[model samples]
Target: MSETINTPRQETVTAGISEAKLLGSLKHLFASSFSVLGELMQNARRARASGVTFDFDPDQKTLTVCDDGTGIADFQNLVVLAQSGWDDETMLTENPFGMGLFSVLFACEEVTFRSRGRRLRVSIDAVVEKRAIAVDVDESAPVQGTRIEMRNLAPNLLPAKHEVPSAGIVGLARYEMVEELRAYAQGFAIPVRLNGEDLPRPFAQENIPGEKTDIGFVSVYGIHRAPDRQVVMVNAHAYNVYFLQGLPINGSAVRNGTPCVIVHLDNASFIPKMPDRAHLYDQERAFKRISTSLTELVERYLVDRKAKLTPKEFASRHWTECKVFRRLDLMNDVPWIPASLFFRIGAILESSERMMDRCTALATTAQGDPEAHLLSREDVEQGKFRIWRNTPYAPSASRAAALLLKVMQREEVLALADNLPEGHWLNLCTPDCEGFTFDVHASGCAGKADYHAGDWMSKVTIQLASQAEIVINDPDQRMTPLRCIVEDDWLLLPAGFTERKAFNADLPFGDHEAVCLVIGRGIRWDHPVDALSSYTDENDEYRDDWQENSARLWNALVSGLRGDSIADLVATALNTCTEVVASECHLPHMAVVRTTLAEPGTRVRNAPRMEVVCLQDDAFWESFAASFDSAGDTALKQRLRDAFVATVRPGEIIRTAE
Candidate 1:
């Protein structure tokens, strides 16, 4: 019985490189999981499905994309799901590249498919580990249409936790999938469900019936082919050339079984890389016949609608290319084609009225929330009020004080003191009241006090004159200096005594030079003591000597200028010495006198001139004169001495009986 042995040997080959890297490169793949649903709906449309259903299982993390279309006849077709450039050619009316399924693969790990009479399932991990294209099939599945179930969704890809509606519901409240589905397929109905409930359609503003425009077309060329010419195939022949308006035509002989021209365009722009259409003729003579028919139809439409054809439409209808095909180039020749062509196409494919209703409902639902309205007047006002309270206080006070103190500080009448001196007092007296006498030597003389009497009194007169001068000179009359009287022998007025008598001791005498005062009404009395003290300390000896020699010098300077006009004489002396006049000294006339004295051509002419009326009874002058030798400039000094001696009025010489 060793007759014959039948042996069948199996051959194995390594699979090509895995597409794991390509699959991992996508961004927002799992994030926009609904876009995957849109892709599946597009696949269903290509299969000639009038209705596509999306079913979700929340607990199992699975989504089933089922379509009522001619199912795949063999399970081996499932291996081509994510592959590109497979059945996508000039012959296919829909997308030919199969990458859309890969977008689903990115979102899920396990994918199960049932088509034709077979069932197949694939796992992402298995593909990566095996580095090969693998397919397994079950021949007993009863599904008559294409059904794809994706499982093991990444946790991040899961829909937000929410209550799902029952299967009867169909609207935007379910998911955004239905809107996308309707957008791509014109008359196709898509039922999308989450956890077994169908989603509603999305709102669209442009879908109203009267809102859309009518579709138009133009035919460019004709096709002529002999009927029933069924001779054995010749080498090859270029057949009838036909053109269509707004439709792309592929015309190329097969080189290595690939098309030469592919046209792709969005609403405004054209896609690069026109596909090759050379393979369209080699498939079968039936395909060539189909191509000729489509080309003839396009030409007939162009000829019928030539009046409506724009430059772009005309070019698209008649132009023929040898190497490349461009949709935009064709469109550019047609200028009359409106941009709403795509939308018009969509409206015709779907029922415009239903789409409009769905859009309205969605818009209404989005607008129902109260927070959507812009802020009101009350809200704005309240927000502004809150901000106003948070501002700092020091900056505000500084701004206010800047305005109030501007003029006073500018005129030099009032100065800013760092710190008030010990025992210094400020007396803001009532205007026009006086006879207020206060003794300078009285205990607590440095303390503040207010004294009042009748109007038009002596002290009141003094105070009024001083205040008036201060007000006139000060740019900003912020504060009026206090008025007070000083002792006759006081050399310097104490700090804070703004309106004080100069007294005889304030003038320098003997071999001393007097410093001159500048004539100005507003003089700052409140020179900060610390700053003045620093200056004084730098010239300690000079200040000490001025104080010590005060009494003698005071008597000499004030003797001739006494009584009612002593204030004027004091002011004149200050001006001539270039000393700073106090703001409280109100004798304006003294300013004129000092100006005359300081003039270049004027001698001391107005000075008191004494004439010895009768040669002065004895030789008192002759003997006093004979004791001095007339030498050097002592003559001027001698003359001054003589004039001073003669001018002294002989009073009762009431000395405190020494």
Candidate 2:
């Protein structure tokens, strides 16, 4: 049983206000006129206003705000403006600062208020001069609510327009923002119109496109560290925040640094707000709270949610939420969140109907190389998976494909090897030789990271369990022993990883089971990943003849490693000959393999796959068997010797002359 500790009750303290001081603060308080205008509109809404209108007569250089609501009660007492703090003793929860009316009085040259049968006008000169505010009683054509107008708005104050304009205060309107506003209106049970157009709802199950498409209203309180549709996510960024009337005041792109045009909405009210009412103050406090406070809550919520929804229903609901950008901070911050979630995220990115359509369209216009199969049978049937070899988004497309492969959940994903690193990109390539083949391509260079193939295998099992072939691309320059063992349809490739390699490769790759071991250069390809792009060499030329010959040597090396005879390893020593001849001619695989043969940045296991070379200690074999007991590498030395012997051809001779 857990003991409960009691602490003394504390009262919430608010800062005392001063009228003159606050009036001077408006210069920084409202960066754009929209913020000030938004506050005034919110004030109207708080008073249960049925309608609000902003009219600007440029000819008269005056702006007028009209609202159908309870009228302002006091204008004579300046102390009324000084008592600006929100009063929460009642059920009321609207304006946090009740000084919006005074903020206007201090900002404008002259202010006029007409309501019921009374008219009050106040001039800043009169207030500063300590004169009585002018008031008049008029019974003719009495108005029930309030009408406040001002002449000569402060600089940058909004000049009211009839319709939402493209350049002025309304320019800030975005599709997401409009949507957020619509949702807020429904939640608060109010109707809001921007320049006469009804704010269409965002964040709703259904959407109706409006006459204006740019209004994006979002008051995104929080993002899910793990996105599950069954339970609601408690947003920490919303910890101390709410947007003013739930409108997105700050501009943020949908994915933060990504290319997606939408936004990741944040709250200014939930967090500490800057004096300018611009953005969250103390943003780090919010982020840290997300880590420490909400992790347990989020996990509990997920557990409860999973219990309620079927797998397909859960997946389908989650898929709809893929349009929102995944939060960047929470990925590393929360420990309970499993990396397997990224795989699901990747699926959402790649499997989107719009993206698939784009790929298909690109594939139609471009002819695929004869040796390479660009589209799979399933791809064609589904009208998706087009290979646009020349589009500007090829690199991004590859990332999407990589993400899709990363999160793939299926029974057909078979393990190829043990003790390899995380972050090796795998794809279900439809090569000419097979229906759909599994091919692995490792990105980023492995410097000095641990390799645990078994751990990765567990994750792979959870994500993709396969009954198909897996081909590992064993790059050449590594010092670590890369040996492949045939297990059913698995083509395993051992890698050259060590304890102290130069550390440059840095993007989070690795789960608890396996950390990424990077090698080779981290080359960034910009265009759509073509077969040729994957095989770029010194002169950057791609040729079929060279690829065919390299493939022959590659197949021979695999064959040699599997053979029981040491002679097979010895025979394949000419594999180095294939590499040399290939590299001298700028063969792409040769250039890649050379990284293995070259002097490593750090010392390593140094086992040479006569298939790919690195200097090995002569005594390495003596202790090699003891190094990997659980990894099942007892036969590795025999395999390496056999593969080396297999490198030499029938015409080759080795003789000692005495």
Candidate 3:
């Protein structure tokens, strides 16, 4: 028996805990005290807690977090570094790093954990000193889920609440703490309470009616108002917001007119970074995966609802989202250039009825014409034709064209023909329009080879007269009877023109150019002004001499229409006035004056009239004096000078007409 007792126990070697490293990590572990609440709440959630309750005692400087969940069974596992006490499923789903409890310890001076008829109180200094902390065990203690009381919490760790306990639970009255709790608890899985009052889940998917996916629940919030109509976001938008484990980790909902996407993630996906857990691990990769999945879900949703929605309704509701996701397939029968696009560009599209009529008329006019490309929906998709219009995202003509061609496959651009809406539809034009080198020939003149001269022969020049402006290939082109007419609902071709191999070689020498003039009535150049101002071919790839030649062509067209010189028009319209002066003409400074007009004592209100007077130099005065001498109105000239001297001050204008 002595020999058996004397037998030495086998010595086993295993990794030892490093007290020094654990102490050192305490300082760098949590970036903020707010993380203390998050970590403890997460633990409670992991324990399958139904709710979490908070209580604070100002006199004792203590915060108590109690959760009704599975009580802790092992005390040793709680303090052991890197040893998470969670089950394998919780470990895989939540990826708890066992560093969460340390965050609480880091934020508090003394933390007391009570559960399973046992209580352990540990001070931060005692842990640092490596002193033995005592755990009290008693069978008589009530058995329940975990309750943690953190004493002497770090300064400003949680916003202060009322001193008097209301109904035995302290209420977090300060807005800072209330908002902080709301931010974390709004989308939390379990219910949360303060002072026994149930906190509202304002942004939960159930309240907003979102769709459930494998990874998360998704919804769109906010309105996308158009210039002409308000488009409420009933579908989706790409303003991404990523919520992981009930907390938003990346991005936020932009409350402006654009729609915002809300994704409340499932617990099994997107693990948060350890320690602070402020953001996700591999955030970029997670974002990509989540966004991709969301896009797929949105695509499915749009497709399912497309049959029930009209093209206009669908485009209005989901145009921005469709562009963001490149999911333009849902716009099967929508117009090629929707009015919503114009609204985004700060331009208003003409009436839809009028637009449709124009398209129908153009289609009817182009019937049986060999050169006319009776564009089909398939043609628009295949990039055989492109609609060029400026949008907020696609501001340049080239970018708009490329984006249109890229997104609008198997979809018809319905603005021009095939009963599209009323707006200026853009298309690749003939050689004459592309060149910008052709001279404006007289309306009745025959086609000539050397027609590049700047000289004008006709005193009565041709101007666009009809609302149906049509530009054809040549006089022989049967699309229109006139030699040159702009397509009524379509804009002139963009400035730069590079010959594509796909075009026919037999087109007129300057076929795409605006060579001949066929003016019907006084020109309604408003469409041209809006179209050209919005759409510019100042692209680097198109042409190097575009500015010079384009301006020449534009001026020539304008001169023909208005019968005025370009220099005179520019000087009178632009050089003659300051922007402030011009703006003041419409929005003038006016003052009301009560005067005695009929009788000395009668104070009658007089109608106000405003006039802008220009201050003059000595040269102007001398000229005016000479004019007065010639016209024999010297008294009027002297009166004007006296009025300026007595009433006017530099940089100041009197509002009254007098």
Best candidate, TM-score: 3
Q: Is candidate 1 or candidate 2 better by TM-score?
A: 2
Error of 3 at 481 (Å): 6.4
Error of 2 at 251 (Å): 4.3
Ranking by TM-score: 3, 2, 1
lDDT of 3 by residue, 1-658 (tens): 3554576899999997679776766768677567777677778888898888877655577778888788788876767767879898888787778878877777778888888899888866776677777779956433878889898877767555544434343344542455566567666678777656777665555555576787678764432112123322333334555567766564342333323566787767778876667777887787677767866775665675556666545655565556555665455455433432211112221222322232322231244432232334444456554333221122122312211221221123222222222321322221112111121122322211111322111111223433322222322221222223333222222223222211122222222232223234323222322222222243523332533443344444544344455445544434423352435443322222222224235566443222223444545555666776777466777776666556644435459876
Candidate 1: deviation at residue 594, Å?
31
Give the alpha-carbon lDDT of every model: 0.34, 0.37, 0.50
* CA lDDT, candidate 2, residue 120: 79
* TM-score, prediction 3: 0.54
Error of 2 at 46 (Å): 2.8
If ranked by lDDT, best first, what sequence of candidates would result?
Answer: 3, 2, 1
lDDT of 2 by residue, 1-658 (tens): 9999999899798987564665455446544444445555656766567766665544355667777776656545422543543335212433255445656665568887777778878875565445666678856413766777788866544333334446533553532333333334432224455545555423221221111111222222223222432323334232222233443434321222211111222222243253334454565664454333344443443445445755334333432222122322222211111111211111111123322333221112224432122222344334242111111111123212232222121222211111111221112221111112224443322123222222112121111112222242212211122222221222112123232222122223333222221111111221111211223356755444554554354334344333325445444555544453433323211111222343466855453433433224435443554464546475786675456546633234369797
Residue 329 Cα positional deviation in candidate 3, in Å, after optimal superposition: 3.2
Q: For candidate 1, lDDT tens digit of each residue in 195-240?
A: 3554432211111111111111211112212211121111122432
- Report the number of clashing residue pairs per model: 40, 62, 20
